[model samples]
Target: MRITVLVTAKRNPDLDGAACAIAYAELLREEGYDAAPLVDGNPDAEARFALDETGWARPAVSMSASEIVLVDASDVVGLPDAVSAERVVEVIDHRQHHDAERLFPRARIQIEAVGAAATLVAERWRAAARRPRGSTALLLQAAIQSNTQRLRGSVTTPRDLDAAAWLAGIAELPDGFVEGQFAARAAEIVADVDAALSRESKRFDHPEGSYVVAQLELPGAVGLVDAVAAADLARTERVMVNLVDVDSARSLLLIWDSAFRRWVAARLGVTFTGAGAECSPAVLRKQIVARLRGDAS
Candidate 1:
């Protein structure tokens, strides 16, 4: 059957969603499935998919043309109403929980709080006795290692470790390469505190209840810890910074403003809790919406 794989990632170079999609598509093709990887919201439709910097052409065909669609659930916030596909499948993801039944009722939901969706795909490949060769296996191995922080993050479960071990055996990844990449990336943060803080920004939304979230992607030349510290220092209002390491599944929640900070610390079980005076983008958006609605909460 003809299948179209929808892959997505936060607009960050480090996340490597396109690479994972390419690898998975190759494996699927080897299995005799006509599979092609499509970037979820790509504006271009001709150029082959690449990292954030690469240009891609938007596919001209409709989603209904495919017999089946596999979506990278990590970055699929909402689906277009124009999509009339009969069958849609979801792959691995670790985004915040949402109303899946209401959103995509026909989808095969598989949400695991793992580091990367590629890890989940790799497990599926192994279970099916699919031995991806050459570059496919190597890319999968890199995706897992980068997502798991070289196996240092708390989200690195036993299953993830197992998948990494198996893929590494076949791919033969160099020792300490992942760790070295992280270190090299961390050394790029300079003394410009404000610019560094701006590297990561957060937003909060209050649909009915207040929910806060942050997103950031530091390049190979930026230090995440320093950026987070700068974010904490720059807080002037009520907000929480959930700094997600797109490469490493590690995340740090920086709570500024005393009241909200304490509430999040107690409720969310944050690993690092402290006080500051910053406001997240989510909080700001909520406040604006509240003001516009003439409802003070």
Candidate 2:
């Protein structure tokens, strides 16, 4: 029997990663390939909101295909052990990695520096004169907007904005869609802060040490959790929880490790005056992880 084609993102995929995997697989299937999108791990809270908003099902946990297409991430370290570089037949990503060419030399690789991988997938669809419909369009649009922080994040590029504009044109979004989505996520956090934090938390290994970084959306500046709950959410030696007020584009950063606290204060050119530091220019958890890994010696 012929094996099916599996398209998936890295483990613990966020909005862009999950959306890209599903969208790209649909694109391939339209071209007559037996393709399916699977999630390497469970989606995060914000990603779940997008899934629920579009009525899309959560991705299957595993793929039995021998050959696979990777989306949103290029580094082999981020992939599962069963998916080796040799099995990667193609790569689609917005984040650039130095080892992509070396790892998947024979695969058709696209590593653009856009804010979201969904932008790249949309560009491909537009090039083929194909428009995503219904849930796919909605999820992809939300992924673009969320990753770009409603087009206000520093990581956003012109291509990302263009893709978002195209997606918005096709998607049957509600009035004030972006704002409504953020508000929904904030409400979920308020309903259960512990569940929200646990779903959003991700860990990274740095030269200094391994640490957990988590984030949550808040309707306003009123979302607060006790230290015990915060500590319970962390599974690493150091942890940083960022409570982001999406409407205002600001974040309250709570740090646990003293060394990391000092490092972050120095890096951001700020002084730690209280329990947590308020970042005027809101920072995403992905940006924090990038900064942490990039600064490692």
Candidate 3:
């Protein structure tokens, strides 16, 4: 009557989280565990595009598992309210700041600094000398690309490259699937700036102050930046949108706080002009927040 392991990620997860859930769950099942991947909320744009293209649908979760394994998520804040933190038995994440040790004191924790958590999951499959299904491999490969900005992101590692290369051989994907997946998410952000911002935004603690960082990866993100700025919504929190141009391997930080902008510039060595500043991919939102946590971000 109990599902042995329910692997999951943050609510409304991106491609990296969703793919890690499915592929990692497959690895668990292969090892004779009664496992299932639970996507507690809707998948983000890139994730939805990947699943739909691959003809895979996220499971309708029941939350009846005996144990929980967080794939891309590590903090209690990112998980669903229905999920019991105490039941978490394992965590595989790529972020530095987490409640993993405190909330899941009894759980096994594996946190790395790789670009994608999917990189870690792919390593797990390899360690067991197993091969995921073609679809799973494709999804994992796509997740690596998405999280790594086509493998050009700041957190990208040799292991990320190794995982993607290994999965590519097994993926057998269509010629344009990866590019299409990336384009779909960027187009969605251009279409609905408000929705995208609300969905993709995450709060952060900065040494200068507290701010929310919303991220989007688009080829030419200046127009999208203008659109988000013009929305005129009642934004109560200090928010900065870090728009990454994957094509250029650069980031544009959009903010209105002049003093805080100077602080960001000094901390990150980026110059500002008007409402936005063009910087390297090292200006990733989470990476910036980790700076406050004493990481050399």
User: Which candidate ranks first by TM-score, i.e. highest?
Assistant: 3
Off by over 4 Å in 1: 1-16, 39-75, 78-87, 179-211, 215-236, 243-252, 269-297
Candidate 3 wrongly placed segments (more than 4 Å): 1-3, 58-62, 206-208, 233-237
lDDT of 1 by residue, 182-250 (tens): 434444333443443444444445544464444432232213445555554446555554444535343
Q: Candidates' lDDT values, in order?
A: 0.49, 0.75, 0.82
Per-residue lDDT over 192-254 for candidate 3, one digit per residue giving the tens place of the 0 to 100 score: 888878877787765657777788787676557668787543244466788888777788888
Model 1 quality (TM-score): 0.64
Candidate with better TM-score, 1 vs 3: 3
TM-score of 2: 0.78
Model 2 lDDT on a 0 to 1 scale: 0.75
Best by lDDT: 3
The TM-score, computed over Cα atoms with residue i paired to residue i, of candidate 3 is 0.92
lDDT tens string, model 2, 39-148? 76667667777777788876554556777888988888667555778888899987643468888876788987788899999998899888877689888888888777
Give the 10-residue window scoring lowest on summed lDDT in candidate 2. 221-230
